[model samples]
Structure formats: structure tokens, C-alpha cells
Target: MSTPDNNWEDHWRETLADHKASPPSTMDWGGMEELLEAKVAPLSPIKAPISSLEGKTLKLPGLPWPVWAIAIALVLALGYWLGSHTALGVSQEMNTIPKKTSLADALTPPADTIFDTLFSVGANGELTEEIISIERAIVNRTTAQKSPEINTSLPAGKSPSPSTPVNLNREKLKAGSNDIAPSTTPAVLLSEAKAPTTSPEFFTGIRRPDTPSSAPGLSYDLSSKPTVRPNRGGYVRPLKTLSPPTDRELLEQRIKALSLSEKLVITPLRYKNGHFPAYRPRN
Candidate 1:
């Protein structure tokens, strides 16, 4: 119960004072194990692990992934088919427009027998929006189609295939060349033509056909000339003259015709400093 550490220095010091050193304590292995076992007790047994959850109704609300995928696929396929069918029909209808005919027949005047035709827009005929739209579409489409046909109808743009050598069907080219340009040039307008003058031979001796006389307020001479007489003074003819450079004396008469502008262009160059001043050549 009372144990102490043994030191040789304490024994030597205490020997002079007549005191004895205590011996070192020793442990017994068997006795210590006996004391430990006496203090401990055995533990209780462990319970079994949980087996199953408490029972209740379970609801798994869901569509399977495969089913959802099939539904989406069906909807997309249906839309594709409907869109393709509609597009095909539209293309066919677009290709079915009537071909162009000669402009003469198309532009011919409608019969005036009908009241609508008589009141219609002049010799140029009536133009509606629908007609112009259809005409422009036809021209644009035909031009695109013509390029391909020209390429195929004869090896157009081919480097003269060595095997076939583009036997340039000359007869076809010559025959078609006739149709290339328009057959008729469109009408150009000259100044309006004067009405034919009455022939003197046709009226040599016959009485004039109720022609108006210069004087008014007189009786008619139906027996011979058949001149028309009305109540008015006779008209007098005035003399007309243009101060322009007239047709005959255009060059000689400079002062009469030349304006300040004309005097500039046609004025003769005068030599001032022997070098004709600084006239820039018409650049």
C-alpha cells in the first residue's frame, strides 16, 4: 500500500545519519490479471437487423420512358408527312401555269360591241394587278429554266467532250437562232402626219360644199360656190417672223442671233500676249 522509489544517493546520505534505503517494488503478472477480471462483467446480446418496412399502399405515378419516346416520334412523323404532301401539291400547281402567247393576240383591242369594252382603258387596254404579278413570275421562272435547257439541249459549258466531241448540231442552232430575237421591232413614233389636202381637181367646177366665207352678216350663194355666211367681221392674217438665225443666213448674221451664251462658244479667240492667253483645251 505504501510504496517509495529507491535511490542510492538517498541511502548514502541517510547512511551517515544512520537511516536504511527501501527496496524497489516488483509487479506480479498473474495477480494483476486476477484483479482486472474481478472488476469487469459480461455484455448483453445484440438484436437482429430490421427485416422489412411497415406495410402501406405505394403509388408509382409515371409513364415509361419508351412510351413517351414513341408518342413524340409519332407526332413528328405525322407532321413531316403532312408538310411534305402539301409542299408537293404546291409545286405541281406552280408548274401548271399557261405558256406565253404572241403579244399581238394578247394585246388586241377587245370588241367595242360590249359597253365595258368601249369604256375600258384606251388602245393600251386595261391593266390589273393580277395580270402584272403573273407576268413577272412567269418571266423569272422561265429564265432560270432556260439556262439548264441550254446546257443540256447541247453540251453548253462542256469542254468539248473528247469522246462525243459535241457534234454541234448546226441545223438545230440555225433553226433556233431564227427564234432568238424578236421578229418585229416595237413601234417608234414620228411626229403626227398631216391630214391629206383637198385636191383641186376634185373641186374644179363643182360648187363648194358649204364652205365658210371670210365675211359675216351676208346671204349664202348656194347657186354656184355655196359659201357659208355668218354674222361676224372677217379675220385678218398677221405677219409672223422669228429673230433666230434663220435657215438661210445662219452663219453670216452673227449679231442678230447671238445671245451672251452663243457669243461665248462661237466667239473667235483673240491673241493678247502672243500666246493666246490661257485657254485650257476642252479636257
Candidate 2:
């Protein structure tokens, strides 16, 4: 008698042989065609009604057209009148100018009795008898101080006294009057000529120093001193660079980098010059 395992193996061999001979007639799939057609058919779309406002005329309230037209006309007329008058006014103001006159002529004294009573003719109005006497006294005192000569004439001058009669010369008075008049008016001589050397009397109160002040904390040494600067030096670290890899490490790195990916590849035409081709997938 044979074992059950052997029997089962023999049964499977027979089944496989029968299948290879006729192949089980191919399954009947014609019944599923109706289900596929039903799934493929699309549904009809829903329709909506159009709005009532379409194809209709727009409505608005009535307005007064005549009033607006009159207001626009009035504004245009006023602007035209104002523009014409402004140009005419400016031209008239610029064309009619007044003449110029001298200030000296306006300030001159009038030849009437009113002006004559207020202002007299030459030095008479400016200086009275008393003022003249005062000026003469000042001039005499200055002359006496400058010149020490006596003013008496007596053969050999027996003696001069306060009671002696002094003669006043007209030439001296004329020269003094000319000098005083010019001095009161302006410094005309100072502008025309250089000033003379001042007398010793003018510098009587001023004095010069013989030596510099030697007071404590009052002087400073102006000489320059030499500066000593520090000399700085230090060491700088160099930058690091990569060394070449060993043969074993290089092989291991290449093997670890192996990979697969989907990419696009193109084929060039052998006959075309600049027109190659479009891209295609290399799958």
C-alpha cells in the first residue's frame, strides 16, 4: 500500500496535466457589460431662469435743465470780464511813473522872510560875539604854551606888565577863522594828507616794560619733548585645508552613492544643425 502524501502528489500531477490540455475554457464575462454601460452614462444638467431686469429700460427722476444752463453761462461771462480788467489795470500802473528829483534842492533854505528870520547867512548865525571871544581865548592859551616868547615891543622891552595894551592883528584873526571853519565842518585835511608825528606830551602817562614778568606759575616752557611709542607684535594662525582620500575610502564612498531615479532624456537628429529634439521619459 502507498502513503497518503504520495497519493496527494499523484493527484496534483494529474490535475496539472488536464489543465495544460484544454485550459478550462476561459471565464464567461459578457454578463458585466450592462453594469459598465450604466456607470459610464452622465446625468443631464439643471437649467436656471434668467433675471427680469434683462432687456429692460433704466428709469430716473426728472431734472431742471434750463436752470443749470443759465448758471454755467453767468460764470463764464464773469470770468471773462475779470481777466480783461486785471490786465488793463496792471498796464496802466506800469506806464504812468513819477519823475525823480534831487534831495539837495528840496533841503535848500527858501529866499523868503520866514526863512531869513530863522536862519542867518554865514558864520553869523553859528557863532555869537561871546562864542568868538571864548574861541579866541582858547587859541591864545594854546599858542602861549607852544611858544615861550614875550608879546611886548618896547625898544628893548624895559619890562612887560599886565596893564600893557596888546594889539590884535586882522591877519591873525582871518587865519584863525579859516582854520576853525574847516575843522567844524569836516576832517578834510586828515583825508587829503597824513597826520604829523605826535608830541612827547601826548605819551606822558604811558610806559614800556623792561623785562618779562617772573611771577610764580605765570610762565610755561614752549620746547617740544620727544614721544616714545610702543612696538606691537603677535603670531597669526594659518587656515586648514583638506587632505587627499585613501584608495579604500574612495571605493567605499562610490559604492554608498549608488542610486536609481526617473529622468528625462532627449535624442538629437543627425541631419539638423541647431534644432535638436523635445524631451522624453527614460522609464
Which lDDT values do the candidates have, in the order given? 0.32, 0.32
TM-score of each: 0.16, 0.19
Model 1 misplaced stretches (Cα beyond 4 Å): 1-61, 99-105, 108-283
Alpha carbon deviation, residue 106, candidate 1 (Å): 4.0
Clashing pairs in 1: none
The root-mean-square deviation over C-alpha atoms between each candidate and the true structure, in angstroms, is 37.3, 42.2
lDDT of 2 by residue, 60-162 (tens): 5455888767877999999999999999998898878643366544443332312111111111122211111211211111111110111223434243221
Quote model 1's TM-score: 0.16
Q: What clash count goes with each model?
A: 0, 0
